[model samples]
Target: EKSIILLPRQNLEICSRRSSRPLPDPRPASLPPSSRPVERRRPPSSPPHLRSIRPSTRPRPPPRKSRRRKNSATFRRSPFSVPRYRPFRACPRTTSRRCTRNGDSREKSSEIFTPSCVIDFVFRWGAFVLTSRLAPSPPVPRQGMPGLGRGAKGTVYVVTDPSEMLKVLHNEGTHPTGAIQYQWPTKRWLKDVRSHLGGGDAPGEDHGFWGDGPKWKRMRTFLQTDLLTPRIAKGYLPGMIRAAEYASKGAPAYAEPGRFHIFSSRASFDMFSSVMFGEFSRMANPGPETSERDRMFCDHALDAAEYLFPMMSNPRELFWSAVGVRTEMYDSFSNGWKNAREIAMEKSYAFMDRASEDRLEGDFQRRSYLANALRRQAEGDAVTREELAEMGFLILSASLDTTSALVNWLVLHLALSPSTQRTLRKELTAAMRDRGAETLVPEMYQQVRTLPYLHAVLRESHRCTPAIPINVIKKNKASALEIHGETIPQNSSILLDSYSVGWDPEFVPQPERFRPERWMDDAVEGRKGTLRQVLDHKMYQKPFSQGARQCPASRVANFEVLTMISQLVLDWDIALSEESEKSVRSFQDVPYYQGTTVQPVMPGFSFTARS
Candidate 1:
């Protein structure tokens, strides 16, 4: 038996199954010459599968020479043919086969193999999943929704959800790591400089601010127990009041009218110097002939420390420094460190001498941070002179900038919100009147702290304009951190966006509006509740951060700011100068910048003594 299959548009031909003879060319008589198909015979030994019991006599059409000239209408009109541009659709009938174009082949089959449909489906869905997992999140507007993002440093997990943030921090086991500490940039730069100068590259044990492990613990404990405790912090009240009195006296003659930050900075330095080093800084006092030179040098040093970290961290600045294009910045940084170190050393020596004499005379009343450290040293503690100097510098740097910035921001907020300022003054007046005090005195420090409205304003200010916008980078070491439903890998850098959480509507209703009332118990009505209730709802306010590694001077900072604000509001009426108002208005228009902190850049304001 023999069989033959008729291909589409092919000419019909015949051959005997038992004979190997070639079949005659069988062109159909009715077909045109150009449309006729060529004919060929199958071998006698052809496979049985290729053989057919019967052969069709119809002739097949000629092969397509070029598809470019073919009528596209035919394929478009045919239900079996797919358009080249459109995605391939699955055929309705699985058994149906049609002569369809398959790349360059012209063939007939029982089923068409179209994997493009599956590929198209997977590509579209797979891309979305991958992008969501890997890509950085979008920018958050002032009043926009919050989400995760990425930066040059590492992954930035921005959680606007207070509860979620609390969970992450709460579970951040002891020794929670934060973004590279501010000190690292300068430290690394200095280390490189030392290495280039033929110093060994071997790492030394970190001490003071940047130290971790045992050293960090010891330093933190010493600070908490001996210096920053509430009692110890309160002990600085007399010094703080003196600084405030000096600031009030010199408020009128400061370099600029509304630039009260100058006074705040000087006052903070004076208070910190007196409390920590047992010497008063005459920085805020007016002089006839450069009497404030040392104070100015101290200010320059602190400013240098601030700009040094940023300059070192900035690649462009580093590049410029390397090529000697901008040597001024490098010189400025070097001078700043040198001046600060010299000052720290001088103060350390003075304290050591005073402490030794005090110990000989049995005079424990002159106790100061330096004196206490000296006492520890005398008791055979391992504290070094270099360590003491470093700690002093760190304390001055931390206290001056942070407290000055906070006081500046708080006063700015009050100046902008006059009604809020009036309310605060009223509260202060009532408290003072109740105590029959005409002026804020050392004894009234405790009373001023208890003023609910004043404290609320401070809390609200800290929340809205966190001194450190994103808490220092926190690192998880033990296991992967789970936030929301996503699992952050182990040892990943965690950045809690305090700015985002501070403005989140869930924790703070009308977050954009500056309303101290939101924090008052009497103001908690309608949909919004009291500040305590809100804090209870999600303990989200972490201005000083929450952990063992939290800022050690937080209580002292609070006391300093509270005392300054009380004195200023009690004795002076503040309002933004015209230039200051314009600057503040512009700040409102575009409120944020990505940097070490995210707080309002306020304008200067004039202060008038209250009659």
Candidate 2:
């Protein structure tokens, strides 16, 4: 027999039953004394604890409904209950606006941080970074039209075919040129800067780099006077050679681990500063002490590289900016361009002031780009100070990064090949001796420029790794463009694929090999395979691009690169450091797309002075 115990104080009943069926009632089995069935006394055979209990037969009571109202007030009074309804409230750190769902007011969306937003933001940038590190090519997908892709600004058309690239770049009328979205951060900073400077919206007065039609033509014309002309470029050679001599001395000693880029970047800055800024250049009074301005410029110039790609690839930048949420990345991007612009404008205003006072000194200073522009302005030219400042910023930007990067790549290539260095030195020595110059001088430029070996080396390096791999252009025509029998929609973005085109086996035989001799005019490795023959019969090397929108400073850049290479070869013997070699086995191993330029992750090298 089963025992049963009913405790009135506890309002509970404990009992053991043999029935297999579960109780239908949800309430407790306890009952009032009158309603309870007649209880039988416990038998003596049972234990002492069981002797006090009694057996009974009774059914459980029916479940009772909640008497209190199930409202907001009732939920608050109960310690265990959570509020089912949330009062409508303004979004955190956002404007006064409430969100509603199905006629019920709720907290604004901005207050809640959901998993989806975090996942998207992380995935977008994380995948991009991971793919860039592991993949051999760019992270972007190649689909749609023949070479279609996408970027932050618009649709990307990567034209890898040499013929197609030429067709797109050459047809400027049909496809108006535009700056790469890689420069989006810089452009955005400049806009903010102009507003602060009270240079109110001049809707039609876009700068030449981004503007098209007559505006672009006018800006290019103004720049051509100082940059494109061979005569003026030649005038800067003396200062350039002096700068090169100083740089050659600054090379790291044998067995010392030093970054090739640091050596090249500092040297390029000094070279351009002396040539472009003249007396205003920080390097004018070179000493052991580093200038605060120079430090700021160096530290911040390449900071964009780390921030730009993420900003472009991730759409979250737009959302944050809209909500006035200034992220670390956005701030970094802004600061880099802001500091650079500050320095550029400072130098520009100084140059303007000096021009007004007729205080310009030295031959280089008098013939400097700014002085030339100022003279032109005095002679009825309509160039404004803001325009002049923008040009100055561009010059500074090029010197600080792109030009230096090219120097780094060129030196890296030479460092890997000792024979190439020796060959280059011999060429330089012959060129200098031919002009009866014991040392490198401006007089030997004509001979040095014509050296077949030097030209071959430069071309080979550029072919292997161009400073700017993808040249961006837009199809501005109203009608679609049909190329390779594929129709490219109107206003499609085109990327002249320099890297892929340079490496294409069909266009370049043994494209993977860094053979400078392939560029030689009299190369015996198949006459048709030479760069000269190809240029004559088929496509252009296009390192500086082609057509009306090609880089105006190409001539200036080539001269600077050649001068530095010649000096470095004659002065020091360069080789890759042991640590650097362990990381970078070949050109393919280097990381691509550092700040939209093809500047690789070059670690360091050793420089031994030549006997």
Candidate 3:
């Protein structure tokens, strides 16, 4: 028989007797059968010498307890040996909550570790899923059922109220505009383009539209004061007018039934190209002498524009991009950007080569915006080829997409409304006659720009269909925004719903009707003559937005659109085809804006040369 005794520090000792009896199992019966210790018996027949020996029964010395030194850094698990607490507070957006460990409430004196703080950090920067797993905070208080809603991404507060929107827009500090380039595929695609152009990892603070802060401010000031002002925009009008006339050569092809682009897309490309890149302008105006290389380059540029459209329009592209998933659409955008950049760079090098030799001269050559810029570079301006590439890409992209889309809408609207067209043409004819200009000229820009009817038409068209549907701005992280008696959390994105604002009944009376008279001062309520009275037009028409984040090229866009429309009206009697008219009617049925901008998916149109 054996007796098991527990010694000091939980050590075990066995004292055995030379007998057949077995000691009871030392392990607890509560343990599973599989986990219990097995029993063993001694042999029945023992050797004579072994049988003669008896087990020692004398008490043994106690087992010594294991001890740690007083100054030891090693951790010992005990009820009193609680973890030393480091300060961890919850996110300010969240409320304080009781924390427990192993079903025991944490002591009030001891600091509790809150996982929310870490989760919030990850959520803000890394956009991790851990934050989503946490219990949601109390809903933000709203005022009288405001149209405030959340974005698909995170912490995005979409503001639809006009009054609140105006406040958000003007308060640039509270709602600073940013985050366009950060969206999935756009960010990736831009990076690739920048890399190809030899631009640093990020776009130049001044040249890029997506950036915010001092660099952006300085750039914006320079652009507004020096480059994109009305005066500067007017100076480029001659070149733009010429480009429009050049693009008019291809009107017949676009006029064909079932043609998708109509003519505005190609026309815009030519207008901007001639003004931006002197040599590149020829590609848009292809001829018998036009080379295969130029045609390929033009195709690539158009391809890139086509590919980029979906990324802006489809919100799902952002999700797929975030997950690093490659869809067919993503591949197309990527390849298009790559091919465009490569070909454009080839043309840029050739242009630079010519510029270096001072071989470029003449009124038409001087019209290139790049030529002067290249000259500045040669004279020790801090300009790089990469910057030049970036500027070209920016100009081209803006012209081909945003400007082209605007042109399409303006032209389509004019064609549908023959009365509006006739009134506009009469106004144009009278203005031209006053200046004794047989055709629209750059010098007549000031008069044309101030034309009340023209301005009213542009404003009315924009009101009906805003170019950018939703403009994104973010609230400062350190401050919460209070709008319409509701609290919007800091770090929330304020999506200015320009489209909805345009259609708001409170801001616009009869928002459904296409009434240019609302913008006009005298119209018989709509019958304003040359000597017209100005109206109290308080409509919030910020198509290009307001303040520092406003589109820098707004003036340029207006001038180009006005010039093209004026020239087209004078030279061609544009008529919408049956299919196009049907498309326009259907479009009117649903007044919702589509894509990043308002892209018109019309059937086609016919252009008749006016005799």
Q: Using lDDT as the measure, which candidate wins?
A: 2
423-464, model 1: which lDDT tens digit per residue?
Answer: 988987877787787766555666434588987888777666
Task: Give the local distance difference test score of model 2.
Answer: 0.53
CA lDDT, candidate 1, residue 566:
81
Model 3 accuracy (lDDT, Cα): 0.49
lDDT of 3 by residue, 99-178 (tens): 22223322222211222222221211222111111112323211110111134323444343445555565555732554
- Candidate achieving higher TM-score, 2 or 3: 2
Residue 285 C-alpha lDDT in model 2: 28
Candidate-wise lDDT, in order = 0.49, 0.53, 0.49
How far is 582's C-alpha from truth in model 1 (Å)? 5.7
After superposing candidate 1, which stretches have Cα over 4 Å from the reference? 1-153, 166-174, 178-182, 189-209, 255-258, 287-293, 317-331, 359-365, 441-449, 504-510, 523-539, 579-604
> Where does candidate 3 have its weakest 10-residue lDDT segment?
1-10
Question: Model 1, 450: alpha-carbon shift in Å?
Answer: 2.0
lDDT of 2 at 594: 34
Per-residue alpha-carbon lDDT of candidate 2 for residues 468-513, written as tens digits (9 for 90 to 100)? 5444344534556655556666566664443433444444555556
